[model samples]
Target: MRYEKGRKDASRSRIMEVATQRFRGDGIAASGLASIMSDAGLTNGAFYPHFPSKAALVRECVAAALEGQSGQIAQALASGGLATAVDAYLSAQHRDNPGTGCASAALLPEIAREQPETRQLYTERLMTLVRQVSAALPPHTSDPEAVAFGIFATLIGALQLARAVEGADLSDRILAAGADAARSMAQPRGGAGQEPAETGVTIAAKTERER
Candidate 1:
């Protein structure tokens, strides 16, 4: 009984891990349960014993992915400032490795269409990231929270545009530009009480208001 239980637990873990990759890379609806089970070298029957349904498994996988990303961001922050962390993040390697990279960049669009539980989980994960960035931001800013939002918007918009572009050169350029802009915005203004520039104007907001 003990041996069988251990095997079952291992299989369940494998399922969750595989599902996380597929759901992050693809969408939740595209990653069928049978395929996930087969990829884990298990039969379909074994899956039900672990999760009540596909949705349940997806929820678990999404939660796991969120937690994994949170841990990565935390580790990056522990090492250095926002620019340092972002320089590592918005790179060719990270862009190439979407399967195991930031969950926000990988799964933002899908999260909008996911169930309430998944959306809630995604929200919590994002808040954690915003908090991490906000903490790393320099003290001279008038509103650090607002600065955090600007930084995130810039990062996501650049990455999305980069991902949409076909050429490798353009993609890398977009990522680099995004990282540079984020770094520039993160710097505190000169001595004592100089107010930072109005850098929080989001690209989206500017385009809409301009139009």
Candidate 2:
């Protein structure tokens, strides 16, 4: 018997949602299709109707995740500028909740090893994210796109490190350090021979050095 289109679509959405969390919480390779299907309340056979293969599901999920993150970052930037966005990304809640946190922090290594098509999709989505940040930067900032990339990389790397290590104190420090690094990168991208503006972290460091 043929299922209704709406039902099929709903089933596909459920599968993607469950798989996205599973893949992020557990590494992609570790999250088996059987487990994902089961978690989605579907039998193994129900999988093929929505997606031809596991890789296809992964590609779609990653793309969706990046799109969601871009929207969130845009909102944060709008409300409190890049600083708020950076803090939200590197917060302890984000670090502890890999299942619901940044896809890059959860799966960058796997992403690097994905097939060419998956990488291409990720690259395009990444550029969209970069553009979102670039648009938020100051008009006087030099190479805003490049600065956005630096800021994103800093946030992603710091979040991953924070999640990997043991201990609450160390993890919190990692988040703080990551926020500082990301903010430092977000500082004014000065023109030639001009000083970049000082961030809070930099000002504190300079004061410590003077003392």
List lDDT for all candidates, in order: 0.78, 0.91
lDDT of 1 by residue, 108-186 (tens): 7777887898788767777877887888887757688888888888887787778779999989889878987887778
Best by lDDT: 2
Q: What is the TM-score of each candidate against the true structure?
A: 0.83, 0.94
Kindly give the stretch of ten consecutive residues in candidate 1 with the minimal lDDT sum.
Answer: 195-204
Per-residue lDDT over 122-176 for candidate 2, one digit per residue giving the tens place of the 0 to 100 score: 9999999999988888787778998889888889888988888999999999889
Kindly report which residue stretches of model 1 are placed more than 4 angstroms away from their true locations once superposed.
1-3, 190-211
The top-ranked prediction according to TM-score is: 2
TM-score of 1: 0.83
lDDT agreement of model 1 with the native: 0.78
lDDT of 2: 0.91
Error of 1 at 140 (Å): 4.0
